[model samples]
Target: MITEKAPGKLYIAGEYAVVENGFPAILVALNQFVYCSIEPSTNGTGKIVSHQYQNNAVQWHRQGDQMIVDQRDNPFSYILSAIQVTEEYARTLNKPLDVYDLHIDSELDSASGKKYGLGSSAAVTVATVKALCQFYHLPVNNDRIFKLAAIAHFAVQGNGSLGDVAASVYGGWIAYHSFDRQWLAEQRKFLDLTTLLNLPWPNLKIETLTAPANLALVIGWTGKPASTSQLVDKISLFKARQQAQYQEFLNASRQCIQRMINGFHAGSLEMIQTEIRYNRSLLQELARRSGVQIETPVLKQLCQIAEQFGGAAKTSGAGGGDCGIVAIDAQADLQSMINQWTAENIEHLPLAVHFMNNVHRYTIKLK
Candidate 1:
């Protein structure tokens, strides 16, 4: 059996604007993960199993090197996309494919099956692709895994910045600039998977970031799940209706992320915190203009309490509701903040940054 895992992620800055090509976002991988394990099957049939779904398992079969499933929806969509793309790449390598039972388990959600806004879908896609690559004994690195996973994710979702996918594959604090999806779509019309993976995608960048020694990260859950895609779609419509304001938001977000990146490099926690606060304000403005609630009342309260405790806080993702992140001094009154969040019915997630050693690093360049 081959097992692989990818960590869940939170957007530290640059949410709505990062969807545009070349826009930068900062995200951190959390210790929570989705694990995928593949085992060779002798019964000439394959199964995909996940306890999170309604049915515990879905059976699959290989028909002339193609894995076919009866139901392709929701959670299965990402898994199936990963399997198909990975198998296609393996065929490009002239590698033989075999029947295997794939199992998935996730800690990215709550015990009650509520999402924590930790990018579970992206984590599962990355984990599935990595597990299959390992099973086929394909020589792959972080970049390869990331590319394959991103392709699979885009095939299903068809939108978003893909920063979560990068965070999952790289497993650390990263500054990610999205690639040109239109370019990718056009290339996919004729290019093979292996060829596509080898190309230096336009505007795509992923760079590791370091936090100051005195900085501490905190996460609080609003216990309300938000559909990121729905909020993004609303914002897209707003962009069409209000082009000038949208561009201004994008430019402001780009500048804010660049400053935050500089703070990381200079080991300046104050600078990072200031930028975090600025980013939050940018998102709030976007939400107001777009008529999308990027931050809910609960998230607002969460941030206010953090500020009262001398921390910088903001809604993590597309954020109608989900989780809010805070960056604070390591010696701040974290316990008091947590107690206040508890009083406000917010759940404090005790998560640490997840990191992987010897991963490939990209240079930081903001466009």
Candidate 2:
């Protein structure tokens, strides 16, 4: 048996901007993770067990040149896609592929199963791809696994920035530029799976970054779940309608992200704090112009609370609701922030920084 675990992620900055022309974004992998357990089976069949899904288990097998699952509900579609894509890549190299049973689990949510807007899908995709490669003895590295997971994720969701996938594949803080999904979509028309895998994903940039030495990470969950797609669509329509204003917003966002990056590298707490404030303001202004509520009232309240405690805060990810990230130093009272959040009915997540220590892939174990 082989097991792979990958961490979920929180977007520190650059949410909507990364979707357009691959602007940079910052993300941090949470200690919370999604796990995949794989074991070879002799029956020439595949099975997936995921308690997270309504339909917990789905059995599948290959038929001539296709994979067919037993259930139409298809709860583990992301895992299935990972398997099929990996199998296709293996066949291209004339390598043998074996059937396996995969069990999925996650530690990125509430006991009641309420997701704190962690990138669960991306984590699962990365873990599944890693598990398949390890089980089959594929000579794939972290970069290839990241690309494969991105492909599988796009195939399922149709569109995404893939920041979460990057964070999962390469744990720790990262500055990322999205791969061109528009180009990928067009290429899918003529390119075969193997050819697609070989195509250089130009313009996608990912660099491991360090957080400021004095910066403290605080995550607060807004009880309400958010649909990232819906929020992104709202912002996209706003961009289409208000191109000039959106352009200005994008430019500002780019600068702010850069400033934050510089701040992280220089270990400048002031630069980090200033950029966080600027980013929060810019996001709110963009929301006003877009006619979309990117930050809900509770999220605004979260910022206010953080600010009152001398910390800078902003919504993470596509956030109409979900988590808000706060950055502070010794000057800010951590306990006071938590107490205020509790008073306001916000749940302070007991999550901290996770550094990847120059490694790109998850910890894989064989049993």
Candidate 3:
């Protein structure tokens, strides 16, 4: 059996604007993860099992090179996409396919099956792709894994900056610039999977960052799950209606994220926190203009409490209600802030940054 894991991620800054090509976002992979384990099947059939879904395991079979499955099981979408895409790449290498039973388990959600706004889907997709690459004896590196997983994830999710996929595959602190999805969609019409992976994706960039030594990261969960896609959709609609306002938001977000990236490079905790506060304001203005509740009332309280405790905080992702992140001086009174959060019914999640040392070796060529 081969097992692989991908860490869940939280967006640090650059949320709504990052979806546009060449826009940047900062994200960190958390210690929480989704694990995928696969082993060869002797019965000539393959099954996917996940404890999250209880008894709804998906049974699938190969029809030629295509994997056929019941369309009713939505949970298998990401897994199946990963399998099909990886198998396609395998075929490009003249490698043969075999039946395997794959099992998935995740720490990206609460015990009661509520999502914590961690990037579980992206992590699961990356884990599946990595496990299959290992299982197929493929020569895989971080770049290969990220590109493959991004392709699989995009095929299913159909939107977003794919920064979560990058954070999952590369781990640690990363500044990610999104590629042109329209260009990628066009390329997929004629390019083979291997060739596509090798191509320089336009405007795509992923750079690992180093946080200040004394910087402290804090996470608080509001216990309210939000639909990221739905929020994104609403933002998209707002963009369609208010093009000028949307453009201004994008430009402001780009500048704000660039400053934050500079802070990361310089190892300046103060600069980082300053930019975090600014980014929070930017998102709030965006929520007002777009008329989407990117930050809920509880989330506002969460950030305010962090501010009172001398930490900079904001909603982590697309943010209707999920998790908020904070950056502060390590010597500050973190426990007091956490205690206050508890008083407000916020759950303080003790998640650390998950780092994969080797991911820095993978570099992308710009087009």
Candidate 4:
């Protein structure tokens, strides 16, 4: 059996803006991970099991070079899509296939089966693709795995900025500009699987970023889960209706993300905090203009609490709910911050960067 694991992701900045053309996002891979284990199936069939989704396992089979799982409504659609897309990639390389039983486990909390918005879906997709590639002895690396996992994610979700997927593949702080999804989606319909897999994705930009050494990153869960895809769709609609305003917001978001990136590299605490405040303000403004509350009351409370603790805090993703993160000086009283957050009923997730720059490969072991 071959096992592979990928870290969950947190968005440091750039949420809605990254879906727009050329806007950059900052993301970090969390220490928490989604793990996948693959081994040949003795029953001449395929099965997938997830510890987090106990009843979702289903048998699958290859039908005319396409593997079809038994249930279309299975909760583990990301894993199934990853396997299907990887199989198509193998066909591109003329590599033979095998039926395997895949087991998935995750450290990202889904207390009572509700997601924590830690990018679990993307993590599992990345981990599964890597494990399958390893199990089949196919040549793969971080970049290739990223592309394959991205395609699978897109196939399953219809749309995503892929910042989380990149974080999972690259496993560090990243300055990410999204691919032109409008162009890519159109291309996906007509392009052959082999050619599509090899596309340079010229519009995408992903670079490893270094944190300012004295910066302390902390995450606090609002105890409310969010649907990122739903939020993205709402923003997309708002953008379609308010083109001029959306363009202006997009520009501000781009500038804020750039400043944040620079702060990380230069170790400028002032610059980092200032830009984070700007980012939070822009998100609030965007929410106002879009007729949505991206920053819910509890999230605002978290930000206020972080500011009280001498840091800047903001919601991490599509923030109707889920976690918010704080960036502060390393010497700040972290436990005090956590204590306050707890009193306010926010769960502090003790997540930090688990890997440094350019360390993108998944942890693998043979059993």
Candidate 5:
């Protein structure tokens, strides 16, 4: 079988602007990666199987017009989108191909409890695209794979930024610049200190350990399987309506994150708070447009308490729900605060320097 693995990602900036006008987005691929295994098929029986162990395994067969999905738990859109993208990419490369026996295995946390903000969907789609690369023996680079993955997501949703896919493919801090037309990607690599793709800052020590002394974070679930598209669509409408405030917030976010970048380079964790506070205020503007508290009641209380201790907080993912990061400073008890919130169904998923290794080939042999 041919195999390929892809990483999950987190957005540091430009979460909403990613789909429009090439907003600057900073993303790092987590160690959590998705794997795909495929083999040649002999019979006309096209079998697609996914090992979701806890639930029933989904099996599919190609029908005259469409695929007959047997298991309902697994969404059919993802499968169809993958196949469609695979064919399109192969055609673009002028490579001959055929449907094959496919099996996907991932160590990504899909179980309910360990659900962090990792890009599980992006990871899976990247794996599928990589499997196609193996099948066609195509000389696809990370950028090209990103294009293919973006196309798949566009088909799945309407607009999808390549931020998640790029980090997962490139494995570092990707400086994505948005122009009038397309987004350009630049790899952030520190020349001397090598940590196997950790993208370490030249002056910053990797083991500074104290966890952003100025930024204590608490990420809690909104207890909803939020529809990301709906929120995005609403955001588009909001921007169109509140053009000035939206633009201001975007600029504030940009400046804030740029400051954080400079702080990292300068090895001064102290400077991080101003920017975090700046970004948090920008996101707060979304509430007026959103007309709903994307921040849960409990989360709101948590943020209130955090502010009482020291620093500010903001929802990390899409504003409507998911997870958030709080800034902790000198006067705050971060460890105790995190421990206190853990019992309230809030999880403290540690963030570390994640890595991704470049692959030029795959060697598959019969056992």
Candidate 6:
């Protein structure tokens, strides 16, 4: 059996503008990941099985030069895209695609809980590229992996920043700015910052080597599921009309993120607290100006409560409605806040700070 696991990412900065002008973005590969295992069949057909998600098996068959498919859930899209991309690349070197049965599972989605603004689809794409690399044994690196993932993401989700994509692939906190300069093909150049100010205390460790212990956080659920695709499209459509204002808000966001980073490093709770408010104010202003109302009153309430502790609070993912992440320091009123949230059916997730600068590749072989 052939098995492989690949990382997922969270965007620390450049959420919207990373696509605007290849602006800088920061992200980190999370401890959570997606894994795929494949086994070749003597028969000339393939099947995709899911161990974790509540989905049916996807079946496929080879017809002359094409691999025909029948899928139930959408997760299989990644595996197929990976196969097609790899197969196309291999063909340039006089190679044929690997014909095999595959299974995929991920830890990103809960059956129904804690939704963040990060795109789950993008994570699937990242995992797909990783699994495809293992299946084909391609000599692909982090940048190349993200380039391919961008293609897959484009195929389905249209255009996105690839901020989280870079982080998911690389791991750790990153300060990324996208520069659309191409070597062979156009790709993003991420000039990442290792030291970010606003990152939470206990930076969740995915590989055990990057344990930024001074961070702490809690997640608040708005009990609503929001899709990044639609929100992204709406923003793009409105970009022209709101270009000037958007740029200004983004500039403010960058400033807030930088200030947060400074506060995080200075070991000053006051600084951290102040920066969080600043960041939250900018986000609120963006939503108000755009008339997007991404932040609900309840969400704002959660942030206020989290702020009562040593950290600042804000929403996590896209804004229409989803979960939010709170950034806190070591010694605060965190436990009491958790107690109150527990009574409200809100759960506290282990906090994390984005901690990666590059997309990463891992390999394992089966005999």
Task: Identify the runs in model 1 with alpha carbons over 4 angstroms from their true place.
Answer: 55-73, 360-367
User: Where's the lowest-lDDT run of ten residues in candidate 4?
Assistant: 358-367
Off by over 4 Å in 5: 53-76, 106-110, 113-116, 178-222, 301-312, 326-335, 359-367
- How would you encode candidate 1's per-residue C-alpha lDDT over 284-337 as one tens digit per residue? 999888888899999999999999989999999999999999999999999999
Best by lDDT: 1
Model 2 agreement with the true structure over 1-367: per-residue lDDT tens digits: 9999889999988888888766888899989889999998769787888777753445567999999654322326677778877777777778887777899998876777667898887888899999888887787876788878888877776655988988898888888877788888888788886777766775787888777777888999999877676677688888888899999988999989998989888988788889888888888898889888878999988889998888889999988888999988865789998899999999999987666555743322110
Q: Could you tell me which residue pairs clash in candidate 4? A: none
RMSD from true fold, candidate 6: 9.3
Cα TM-score per model: 0.94, 0.89, 0.94, 0.91, 0.73, 0.75
| Model 1 global lDDT (CA atoms, 0 to 1) | 0.91
- Candidate 3: where is the Cα deviation over 4 Å? 55-74, 361-367
In order, what lDDT does every prediction score? 0.91, 0.82, 0.90, 0.84, 0.57, 0.57
lDDT per residue (tens digit) for residues 1-367 in model 5 = 7988877666655566555553555555556667777888889566767664234345567999899753322333555566676676566567786868877665655365333556666777788888877788876666566656655654565545545656666665444443322212222132211121223211111111123434434444434444455566677777888898778767766666667666645646566556656666666666666574555665565566566656466565565556566656645677776665676656665654355456322211101
TM-score of 6: 0.75
TM-score of candidate 4 on Cα atoms, chains taken together: 0.91
Of the candidates numbered 1 and 6, which has the greater TM-score value? 1
| Candidate 3 per-residue lDDT over residues 226-307, each given as its tens digit | 7787688799999999999999999999999999999998999999999999999999999998789999998999999999
Give the CA lDDT, 0 to 100, for residue 48 in model 2: 81
Our model 3 lands, by Cα RMSD against the true structure, at 4.9
Could you tell me the lDDT of residue 28 within candidate 4? Answer: 92
Clashes of each: 0, 0, 0, 0, 3, 33
Q: How well does candidate 2 match the true structure in TM-score terms?
A: 0.89
